[model samples]
Structure formats: structure tokens, C-alpha cells
Target: MADKPSTPLLDTVNSPAELRALPREDLRQLADELRSEMIDAVSVTGGHLGAGLGVVELTVALHTVFDTPHDRIIWDVGHQAYPHKILTGRRDRMRTLRQKDGLSGFTRRAESEYDPFGAGHSSTSISAGLGMAVASDHLGTPRNVIAVIGDGAMSAGMAYEAMNNAGAMDARLIVVLNDNDMSIAPPTGALRTYLAKLVSGPVYRGTREAAKAVVQKLPPFLHEPARKTEEFARSFFTGGTLFEELGFYYVGPLDGHNLDDLLPILENVRDAGAGPILVHVVTKKGKGYAPAENSADKYHGVSKFNVITGAQAKAPSNAPSYTSVFAETLIQEARDDERIVAVTAAMPSGTGLDKFAELFPNRIYDVGIAEQHAVTFAAGMATEGMKPFCAIYSTFLQRAYDQVVHDVAIQGLPVRFAIDRAGYVGADGPTHAGNYDNAYLGAIPGIVQMAAADEAELRHMVATAAAYDAGPIAFRYPRGDGMGVDMPERGAILPIGKGRIVRQGGTIALLSYGTRLGEVLAAADRLAALGLNPTVADARFLKPLDEELIARLAATHDVVISTEEGGLGGFGSHVATFLAANGLLDGKTRFRPLMIPDRFVEHASQADMYAEAGLDRTGIVNTALTTLGYDQAAMTAALAKI
Candidate 1:
């Protein structure tokens, strides 16, 4: 954008300390500059733009009012923390967001002291902040702990759970309710600002405490009613009845974009006597930038884009995404069966269920950020003979693990889980990586887990999950476009728990579980170049291990390698377990499972991550060669020739 917009005020401040030192009147100018810098940086790097843009003034106000590093500030989900990052001495690293060995898109504890708690998944700020506040109290170091949470995140029960705990313990915690999505309280003018400041100030707090003291002396029956009357009178005007009920001193419905409104209210909040305070700050999503302000959802998570035109830069893809295939295929099945319903945890578009919702408007349920609720809701639907497909990101589905085990799996409900973004997610990194589905779902007894090899496989898996009305079934597919294979008009329901041989060849067998099938085939080609045509097979189901296929490959092939996209305890782990139990690893046969390493791989391109994990073609070929008794030097030499 204009070769990086000039940010004189932003450049002058290296950290929040400098930001605080500036004249109070100049803070608005500083915020403007900060917003510009964030906009430019995100436009280049591509990240959570709208959220960050929305919280520009709030970030500035929080940093200015609170003595951060000493005072803790936790941003829920960390989507809006980019501006916070810039103000907190990470201004220089803004360009490196979500890149390999670069700054994380989400707040990371490892990144800086400014980031006290890391958050990638939604609705964890209050819990983490409360824990920090409790720790601080126990240590006798009472510092202000402010948790900035979005309205979307508040839908999750964990936020309330933390608040309930905080209220019970009377922990000094400040929860800044950044209400940008839902219109909880739209009024943000002078009157609202005045009331917010007045209520949060010492005078109002002291008066309230005195009133409570007078009420406490009354009859026990009258005391409860007196307290309720006081709260009811205030909440009638202020609109925080729910928060007040949860034992939080509620303030605001203030204009978050207005520094004048935010600054004084935050200062009052910081200085006020608080057991647990909820400051409701209402702001517009994508506040400053016109493009984002117009279409906030589109800019929520963007690619590199033009500052003037707001057009994102996307690489041309020949095939549809696996998420789209799942949606389209599900739609195809739903057309035939009216009982089909879809569910998503605040990610209808991300899971491609928005397409399904277009045709079956009443059937698709957007359950906000509550993953646990989404799972159980799907389970409830399934109990009624409705084919409920619960679509959620793999990492997010981890949040509903208990529900998966206790509700779906335990009840033996026929709930279909369409797990999207399974495997190494490119920019979002390990936090968003769908690496545990194969492990987690596989562990649940009677739960059938399948990983798609490509788009066609994803389509078939969707059909398969729809057709199979047994127990809980989950199908995982990686992020990004599929391999450009021939499209099937309508996916045929595949045989459950069956493995298929793709290429028949020599004594070296390369068995793949998921999208790694492409890499395995390429590795087979590489092996063919090395005069070793390996037998390539796709093990479709992770849970129902194909004993017959394993026996055939073990009996025939000298070297058998199992490749999967996820970490250990996945398809590879299952295959290894099957082979071990069957005594297939006894004599001359060597079985090696290639999956993600024990540790988390940082953010990178999918190809880079796969290659790093030894799940790429080169890695697969090397594994085959190494296990065949070839030394590192020999394998290196052989690969170089290929």
C-alpha cells in the first residue's frame, strides 16, 4: 500500500512503555498510525485483519491504562492481537506473521512477555486469565488481569465456567467483553460513555458498597431482594443483567473505537475495586478500513491483498477443496434424503457447510463457537433418525473430545463428523493442524475413522458416512485444493474399512492412509526410477484395519511403509499395531510407519511441512531405501541420481 504508510507516531514508540509516555491527547493519533501500520502489514502478510482493525483503539487504551508485562492482558482467540503485537515492540516483525520461523498469527507465550497466554482456539482467555489472576493472588502479587474476549467466544461455555469460578473465589479479574459481532448493546454515545465511567469510578463503587452494607443489616430474606433490586435498577439502564448475575461489577456498552470513550472507562476499570468486573465495549468489526468494514467476514482471515482494491491474491487451483467436496457431496445425498442435516461450530463457511445451508436452510445449524454443544447437538439429531453431519476443523474438534467419547461414542449414536483441515495446515500452524483426529477418534471404541486420499475419496467418504448408520463415523481431509484427479459426478459409497491397491509392483510396499497417498504414488515413481517398483495401496479406514490387506502386503513385500498425514497413534500407528499383533513384523519383513514427528512442526507451506515430516515423495522414497538396508550416504546418492 503506498510502500508502507508513514507511521511517525507508531515508529516513535518501540513498546507500550513509550506508548504510555506519550501525551494523553496524542493517543488517538498514535492509534490511527498503529491501525494504518497493522492494515499495511496484514495486507502484505495476510492474517486476521477485521478483528485487529476493530480493536485498534481498545488495544491502545488497554496498553495505555494498564501497566502491561506487570499487568496481564489476555486476548481471547488472539485474532485481534495483531495491533496489540505492534504496540508491544513486535512492530518490526509484523511482516513475518504466520510464516516459517516467523511471528505466529495468534498470540504465543514463547513470542513475547506481552503475550502472557497463547490462544488459537476461541473462548479460552477468561480461563487462562483467571488462572493467572489466581496464581498472582496466591503469590501475593496483585496485578490487574484483563481478559479481552470477543462476543463470538462468549458463546462457549468455558468463558462462563471461568467467570463462575472467578465470581465464587472473588478473584480480581477484569473481563473486557469486546462485543463486535453481536449487537449486545449498540448505544455508544456520550450518555453510555458517561454512565460507564461513572459506574466504574471509585465514587460509584463506594456508594454501592455502602448501600450493600445497609442492605446486609436487614432481614436475611430482605437482604437478597435488596441486592437484587440494586442490580436490577442498574442493569435496567446499563444492560449487563447476565454478567451482574455472575457476580461481576458490570460497566460500559461504551464506544470501543472512540479513544475518549475507551480510555477513561479502562482507566476507571484498572483503578476500580474489583472482585470480577465485566466491561462491555461495543465496537464495529473492520472499523477503519473501508473494504473490511463493508465485508468483515471475507476479511476475517485473508490472503495477501491489494490495499486499494481489496482483492486477495490466491494461487490458481485446478481442483476443488476437500471441504467443498464434502459440502457438495453431502448436498447431493441430502437432496435424496430429507432427513440429512448439517452442523458447524461457528465455521459454516470454513467447513463448507454454508453451501449446504443455502439449499437446506432450516437443516444446517450454526452453533456459534461451542464445539462441545455442536457435537452433542448432532448426537441429539442422530438419535431422532436424522442423518446429522457435524462439520468442524480437526483442531477445533479437539475441544469437543469429551462429547465425542461420552455422548456420541458411548451412546453409539450414528453422528457423522466431517473433519476438515486434517493434517498440516499451512499458515495457521500446529494449533490449527488437524493432526490428532486419526489418533483421538481411532482411540474411541466403535467409532469408525476415515481419512480421504483426495477430493474423490473425500466425496466417497461423505457418501459412505451418510449411508453408514451404525456408530459415530468421522472422515478427515487436509486443507487446500485436492490433487487434480478425474471428478466423479456423484460419489459411490465405498466399502467400510477396506484398503485398495492403487499400483501393483515389487517386494517394497508403500501403504498410505490419507492425502499422503499422492506423495506415496510419487515415491513409487521415484522408486521405479531407482529400479524398485513398490506396491502402493490406500488404507482408507483408520479404525477398521484391513487385516487381509496387511497380510497380503506383509507376505509378499519385503519392505512395507505406512504413510499418513497426522502424528503418531494415527493410521500408521494402527497399521504398526495390527502388524505387531498379527506377528507380521517377525522375520525378514521390515515395516516402517511414516507420520508427523513427535514434536509440533511450525508454520510453513503444506509441501514444506509434508517433506519435513518425511511424508513427501522424497521422504517416502528415502524411507523405502533406508529400510531396504541402504545407508544414509547410499540413500543420498541414490536419491540424487533419481
Candidate 2:
């Protein structure tokens, strides 16, 4: 009789070797248990629940079959690596996912031996894994290197480039195509169509195998023609003549959830040595749970939720999110104008274009995981006299800098960029944080830039960007909920490069941008109580300099305190450069640029990150008082008023 399946199956199993030690039937049950545990953990912590749940069977099978740590497994985007983390030694610390000092939401090389390659951005896995494989070959220390890439990520040119190169080099790498047919939103484009063809044509595989047997005996000289005939036959059946042309051992569109299918295929590939191989494993986005399967996007990334009800455990708040505000404003504007079209790179919900897409389906474009393509596509639409609003996150837009400069800015097209997550994004960490958008966009020629202070300002900025067809314009807004300000009934555009003075003062001038205005206001109130009246101005435009307003404030006040939510090469840096280049710093006015210091800030709550960067209200106030030569007593008095 077989012994009762050990509790040690879940508990004592820290690594892949331990997992493999269990019976094959036990391993299958372990996959089910892992899925259950993952769902429970994610329901409480609220992370990438769906993707992780979908990859449970695949994850268990891969780790159990392959020699991990030594055998590198590169998870594309790393969102689905929760189960992988749990199976490894990180099971105990899984609760600390995405916390300041805890495990990351995605895979991290530093976190565990399991995570061989770190990834937050998609389409990088294949290249990274191929490099590892090649390096292993060069060192005479051969080991298996597997890249688990998603169907969503396959839309990008870089993934294809990696596949193209890997196929040519014939690197002994295993490429697992985890096809859920979605990337936040449903996948799009010509490549997606090609993958669909690969799925539909099963007969092509048997035909190719039969032809390979014939070609092997064809005296080496006649082998090329037989191979060509097989390739032509495959092209006739499957539209993916492209993959064959690149020379890869393409496998299947197999059931990723079924252990029976996944186990044997993975074993075959692991043992079958030489040449880059592509294993297409089709999966449901949210596999075990019914609710997640129905609403995959909603479950893609979630806040804490009730497991029983499958309801999100949202905090009671009346304040509207910045994303909702942007969506509403886009709908309002698009309703008024026919030419107004919206575009996003696989982030319809994140960028708040779902309503726009629903309202005007023809006008909305969901370019799947292709930032570079989205920017240029928007540029293409703009040239045809259509107003294309490229709604992309700040971090993702960084991928399209060249397109912005060459295609849009150089041509002076009306590509309105709705840059969301314009500051430090919480939980998801540094990779997804929209920190550099302001600094980078400001540097581009023939571009107009603005940062919104609140939801109302974001509306106005969106309108401003839409109306000003003079050139490419971008208005950035932070993540999370707004300050619950009274939103405008109708949208109106603010004057280009003009700043609004929030408060009047005597000694110091506080010039701030975006959400940093709130901090500046707090500091001003604190200073006012200490008998140092500080005037505040919201420098709306980072480019076009707002030179007149900045110059006036500088000449009028003894000190100018510039605050912006970005790093050294950001708004404050630009302000400092302007003051120095314009010869404004040499005189009585001393410019103090309060910006994010030169360092990569770690994962934390946005508030905590702001405090660390000296951009919080207290930090901002203290800096202002110190610049004005005030003691602690004076600073305290200033704080009393605020």
C-alpha cells in the first residue's frame, strides 16, 4: 500500500529537488495545493493573482522536471512567478510581497536562487535566457536555460528579435510561450494573427516530422530541397512561415494546465539537446477560480479581496482615482470632437481608456505591449489629420523616446500624450514608477509638457493638450486617488506655459510642479506663521520654461525653492539649468532645487518614498526655513500656522 502523501510535500519542500523527490501523482496534487495557497495569499495581499494561478501546473512541472538554480528559468514580466517563489525557499516570506523590505511583486535575482533573471517589463526573457545559455556553452559548464514568455509579450518586436537571433545561433534554450491571449487587455496586431495560425494548424506538425525522416536519408546534398518542400508545405498550411524561416524547433499549442501533456513535453525538450526550441503552451489567464476566469483583467492585479465572496476589499474612500478622472475627461472630449482617438500599449484599464473604447470602439486602439509601435502609430494617425491621444504610463513611454523625438516632435505632430503614473508608483516598485517622464519629455524639441496638480488640473491639461494642435503636448498625472477637489463641469484649456499663483508672500518664492504644489502650499502656511510669508506658484510647463513667471519670482524674492516629483535629471534640474544658463543664480536670488536625490529609491509606499526623497510637506518646509536662515523655533512657529 502507498504511504499517506506526506505533509512534507508542502512544508519541507524548499527547492526543486525536494519537490521532485515526491511521487509523480503526489506532485500533481501538490500543483493543486500550490494553486489554492497562491489564491489565498493573493486574496489577502492583492497582487498579480490571475497570471500566477494560471501557471501553477506549468510551474510545478518545470521545477520538478528540470534542475533549477543550475537550470535558469527566466519568467517574462515576472508577474506570474508567485508560485515559483513559493515552491522555492521564499514560501514563508510570501506575505511580504511588494512591501518596502519584502519580496518583489515580480521575479528578482537578488530575492532567491529560483529567480535567475529579474523582469518587470515584458519581451526581455528570451534574449536574457539565450544569453545565459550561450554563456553556459562558452564556460564549458552546460545547463538548461528556459524562458517563460507570455502571448501578450510576443506582440513586441524585441521578443521576435530574440527568437530570430536564438534560432539563427541554434542556442540550446527552451522558450515556453505561455499563451493566455491577453496582456491586461486582449492582445492585438499581425504577430498575434501569426500565433493564431500556429494554434490552428496541427496537421503541419505530423507532416514536418514525416518529411524530416525522408530528408535525413537524402545524401546531405538533396537535403536542402526536401527541407524547402516541407517548409513550403508548412507555409501552405500554417501562416507562420516566419518562425520556420528563422530556424527554430517549434513544438506546440499544448494545454499548459494539463500535467499529463506539460510533463512529458517538458521532459522531452529538457533531454532533447541542441538548437533553440519553442514550446507553445496555451493557458487560461486565471485557471482554478471561476471569477478570475470570467473577469481576467479585473483579477490581473487586485487590492486585497474576500476569498469567499471574491469581492475586492477596498478601503472606504470618496476621493476619485486619477485614472477615472482621465477616463471621464477623455470620454467628454471625444464626445465633443470626432477626430479625438485614444491609443494604449496593452493597458486599456490601467490608462483608463476602457470607457473611451466602449463609447467609440473604432477610435480606440489597444496596441499590445508595443510602446515603440504605439507612439509611432499615434504619429501616423496624427499625420492623417486625426487627433490621437497616446494614453501611456510614464515608465512605458520611456521605451518610445526615439519615436517621440524623430517621428512626432521633429515633424511637430499633434500627438497628445496622456502620461499617467507620473510619479513614484506604490507596490509595483521602481520599474513601473513613472519617475523620468517629465525630465525626458522636457528635453525633447518642439514638445509641450505639463504636470497636473489634481483631477481638475488633469482635465484642463487633457483639454489643453487636445486643443493645442500646434505640436506634440504631454500632461503627466500621479497614480492613486486625487485630493477630492471640486471637479469642473466642463473642460477648459489653461494658457500655454502660464502658471497660476496659489498664495502671496513676502520673503520666499515656492515654485512647484504637479502634486508637489500641495507640499509647497503646506510649507508656505508653516512659513507664514513664523513671520516669513512664502508665495507659491504652480509652474505648469517644464519645457517652454515659464521663463517670465520664474524670472519675476526670482527677481521679487531673495530665495526661490523649486520642488518637483522626479529625480536629479528632472524638473528641479531643468529649473537649476535655466537659472544658471540665464545668469539668474549669480545675484541675490539663490536657487534651491528640492528634487529626488541621485539614487534608485527602493520599493515602498508613495508617502514613505516622498519622505525619503525630502519631498514631503515637513521636508519641504524645513528646507525653505533653512534656506532663509531660520532656527528650529522659527520652523516650529511656521509649522503651527500650517
Model 1 weakest lDDT span, ten residues long: 183-192
TM-score of 2: 0.92
Q: What's the lDDT for candidate 2?
A: 0.83
Q: Mark the 10 consecutive residues where model 2 has the least summed lDDT.
A: 182-191
In model 1, the runs with Cα more than 4 Å from the true position are none
- Write the residue-wise lDDT of candidate 2 on 1-642 in tens digits: 122224445876888889888888887778877877787777767899888888999999899889988999999979989999999888888878888898899998788888888899999999999899999999999899999998488899899999889988989988888988632222234444344344333444455567689789879989998777766754453333666677776665566777866776687678767888777777888898888889999999988877767898777767788889899998988898999999999999998999788889999999899999999999999999999999999989989899999999999999999999988998898888888887788778878889998788888988888798899999899988888789898779889988878888867999999988877887777777677789899888887778888888988999999888877677888888888898888889978988876776778899999988889888887887788777989767656666
Candidates' lDDT values, in order? 0.89, 0.83
Local accuracy of candidate 1 as per-residue lDDT tens digits, 1-642 = 457788887889998999889999999899899888888998888988999999999999999999999999999878889999998888888899998888999999999999999999989999999999989988999899999999499999999999988888898999999999886877746787788888988899899899989988888989888987888888877998988878888997888888887887888878876599999988888998999999978988999999888999999999998888889999999999999999999998888988998999999999999999999999999999999999999999999999999999999999999988988998898889988888988899999888899999888898999999989998999889999999899988988889899999977999889988888888899899989989999989887888899889999989999988888888878888888898988978999999899898889888888888888888888788888999988887888887
Q: By TM-score, how accurate is candidate 1?
A: 0.99
Best by lDDT: 1
Question: Candidate 1: deviation at residue 50, Å?
Answer: 0.6
